[model samples]
Target: MSETINTPRQETVTAGISEAKLLGSLKHLFASSFSVLGELMQNARRARASGVTFDFDPDQKTLTVCDDGTGIADFQNLVVLAQSGWDDETMLTENPFGMGLFSVLFACEEVTFRSRGRRLRVSIDAVVEKRAIAVDVDESAPVQGTRIEMRNLAPNLLPAKHEVPSAGIVGLARYEMVEELRAYAQGFAIPVRLNGEDLPRPFAQENIPGEKTDIGFVSVYGIHRAPDRQVVMVNAHAYNVYFLQGLPINGSAVRNGTPCVIVHLDNASFIPKMPDRAHLYDQERAFKRISTSLTELVERYLVDRKAKLTPKEFASRHWTECKVFRRLDLMNDVPWIPASLFFRIGAILESSERMMDRCTALATTAQGDPEAHLLSREDVEQGKFRIWRNTPYAPSASRAAALLLKVMQREEVLALADNLPEGHWLNLCTPDCEGFTFDVHASGCAGKADYHAGDWMSKVTIQLASQAEIVINDPDQRMTPLRCIVEDDWLLLPAGFTERKAFNADLPFGDHEAVCLVIGRGIRWDHPVDALSSYTDENDEYRDDWQENSARLWNALVSGLRGDSIADLVATALNTCTEVVASECHLPHMAVVRTTLAEPGTRVRNAPRMEVVCLQDDAFWESFAASFDSAGDTALKQRLRDAFVATVRPGEIIRTAE
Candidate 1:
């Protein structure tokens, strides 16, 4: 019985490189999981499905994309799901590249498919580990249409936790999938469900019936082919050339079984890389016949609608290319084609009225929330009020004080003191009241006090004159200096005594030079003591000597200028010495006198001139004169001495009986 042995040997080959890297490169793949649903709906449309259903299982993390279309006849077709450039050619009316399924693969790990009479399932991990294209099939599945179930969704890809509606519901409240589905397929109905409930359609503003425009077309060329010419195939022949308006035509002989021209365009722009259409003729003579028919139809439409054809439409209808095909180039020749062509196409494919209703409902639902309205007047006002309270206080006070103190500080009448001196007092007296006498030597003389009497009194007169001068000179009359009287022998007025008598001791005498005062009404009395003290300390000896020699010098300077006009004489002396006049000294006339004295051509002419009326009874002058030798400039000094001696009025010489 060793007759014959039948042996069948199996051959194995390594699979090509895995597409794991390509699959991992996508961004927002799992994030926009609904876009995957849109892709599946597009696949269903290509299969000639009038209705596509999306079913979700929340607990199992699975989504089933089922379509009522001619199912795949063999399970081996499932291996081509994510592959590109497979059945996508000039012959296919829909997308030919199969990458859309890969977008689903990115979102899920396990994918199960049932088509034709077979069932197949694939796992992402298995593909990566095996580095090969693998397919397994079950021949007993009863599904008559294409059904794809994706499982093991990444946790991040899961829909937000929410209550799902029952299967009867169909609207935007379910998911955004239905809107996308309707957008791509014109008359196709898509039922999308989450956890077994169908989603509603999305709102669209442009879908109203009267809102859309009518579709138009133009035919460019004709096709002529002999009927029933069924001779054995010749080498090859270029057949009838036909053109269509707004439709792309592929015309190329097969080189290595690939098309030469592919046209792709969005609403405004054209896609690069026109596909090759050379393979369209080699498939079968039936395909060539189909191509000729489509080309003839396009030409007939162009000829019928030539009046409506724009430059772009005309070019698209008649132009023929040898190497490349461009949709935009064709469109550019047609200028009359409106941009709403795509939308018009969509409206015709779907029922415009239903789409409009769905859009309205969605818009209404989005607008129902109260927070959507812009802020009101009350809200704005309240927000502004809150901000106003948070501002700092020091900056505000500084701004206010800047305005109030501007003029006073500018005129030099009032100065800013760092710190008030010990025992210094400020007396803001009532205007026009006086006879207020206060003794300078009285205990607590440095303390503040207010004294009042009748109007038009002596002290009141003094105070009024001083205040008036201060007000006139000060740019900003912020504060009026206090008025007070000083002792006759006081050399310097104490700090804070703004309106004080100069007294005889304030003038320098003997071999001393007097410093001159500048004539100005507003003089700052409140020179900060610390700053003045620093200056004084730098010239300690000079200040000490001025104080010590005060009494003698005071008597000499004030003797001739006494009584009612002593204030004027004091002011004149200050001006001539270039000393700073106090703001409280109100004798304006003294300013004129000092100006005359300081003039270049004027001698001391107005000075008191004494004439010895009768040669002065004895030789008192002759003997006093004979004791001095007339030498050097002592003559001027001698003359001054003589004039001073003669001018002294002989009073009762009431000395405190020494």
Candidate 2:
């Protein structure tokens, strides 16, 4: 028996805990005290807690977090570094790093954990000193889920609440703490309470009616108002917001007119970074995966609802989202250039009825014409034709064209023909329009080879007269009877023109150019002004001499229409006035004056009239004096000078007409 007792126990070697490293990590572990609440709440959630309750005692400087969940069974596992006490499923789903409890310890001076008829109180200094902390065990203690009381919490760790306990639970009255709790608890899985009052889940998917996916629940919030109509976001938008484990980790909902996407993630996906857990691990990769999945879900949703929605309704509701996701397939029968696009560009599209009529008329006019490309929906998709219009995202003509061609496959651009809406539809034009080198020939003149001269022969020049402006290939082109007419609902071709191999070689020498003039009535150049101002071919790839030649062509067209010189028009319209002066003409400074007009004592209100007077130099005065001498109105000239001297001050204008 002595020999058996004397037998030495086998010595086993295993990794030892490093007290020094654990102490050192305490300082760098949590970036903020707010993380203390998050970590403890997460633990409670992991324990399958139904709710979490908070209580604070100002006199004792203590915060108590109690959760009704599975009580802790092992005390040793709680303090052991890197040893998470969670089950394998919780470990895989939540990826708890066992560093969460340390965050609480880091934020508090003394933390007391009570559960399973046992209580352990540990001070931060005692842990640092490596002193033995005592755990009290008693069978008589009530058995329940975990309750943690953190004493002497770090300064400003949680916003202060009322001193008097209301109904035995302290209420977090300060807005800072209330908002902080709301931010974390709004989308939390379990219910949360303060002072026994149930906190509202304002942004939960159930309240907003979102769709459930494998990874998360998704919804769109906010309105996308158009210039002409308000488009409420009933579908989706790409303003991404990523919520992981009930907390938003990346991005936020932009409350402006654009729609915002809300994704409340499932617990099994997107693990948060350890320690602070402020953001996700591999955030970029997670974002990509989540966004991709969301896009797929949105695509499915749009497709399912497309049959029930009209093209206009669908485009209005989901145009921005469709562009963001490149999911333009849902716009099967929508117009090629929707009015919503114009609204985004700060331009208003003409009436839809009028637009449709124009398209129908153009289609009817182009019937049986060999050169006319009776564009089909398939043609628009295949990039055989492109609609060029400026949008907020696609501001340049080239970018708009490329984006249109890229997104609008198997979809018809319905603005021009095939009963599209009323707006200026853009298309690749003939050689004459592309060149910008052709001279404006007289309306009745025959086609000539050397027609590049700047000289004008006709005193009565041709101007666009009809609302149906049509530009054809040549006089022989049967699309229109006139030699040159702009397509009524379509804009002139963009400035730069590079010959594509796909075009026919037999087109007129300057076929795409605006060579001949066929003016019907006084020109309604408003469409041209809006179209050209919005759409510019100042692209680097198109042409190097575009500015010079384009301006020449534009001026020539304008001169023909208005019968005025370009220099005179520019000087009178632009050089003659300051922007402030011009703006003041419409929005003038006016003052009301009560005067005695009929009788000395009668104070009658007089109608106000405003006039802008220009201050003059000595040269102007001398000229005016000479004019007065010639016209024999010297008294009027002297009166004007006296009025300026007595009433006017530099940089100041009197509002009254007098």
Clashes found in each candidate (C-alpha, N, C closer than 3 A): 40, 20
Per lDDT, the best of the predicted structures is: 2
The weakest ten consecutive residues by lDDT in model 1 span 340-349
Off by over 4 Å in 1: 1-32, 81-95, 130-143, 161-658
State candidate 1's TM-score: 0.28
Give one digit per residue, the lDDT tens place, for model 2 in 1-658: 3554576899999997679776766768677567777677778888898888877655577778888788788876767767879898888787778878877777778888888899888866776677777779956433878889898877767555544434343344542455566567666678777656777665555555576787678764432112123322333334555567766564342333323566787767778876667777887787677767866775665675556666545655565556555665455455433432211112221222322232322231244432232334444456554333221122122312211221221123222222222321322221112111121122322211111322111111223433322222322221222223333222222223222211122222222232223234323222322222222243523332533443344444544344455445544434423352435443322222222224235566443222223444545555666776777466777776666556644435459876
Candidate lDDT scores, in order, read 0.34, 0.50
Query: Model 2, stretches more than 4 Å misplaced?
Result: 1-18, 58-60, 138-142, 158-175, 204-208, 220-240, 251-259, 307-321, 333-439, 443-471, 474-658
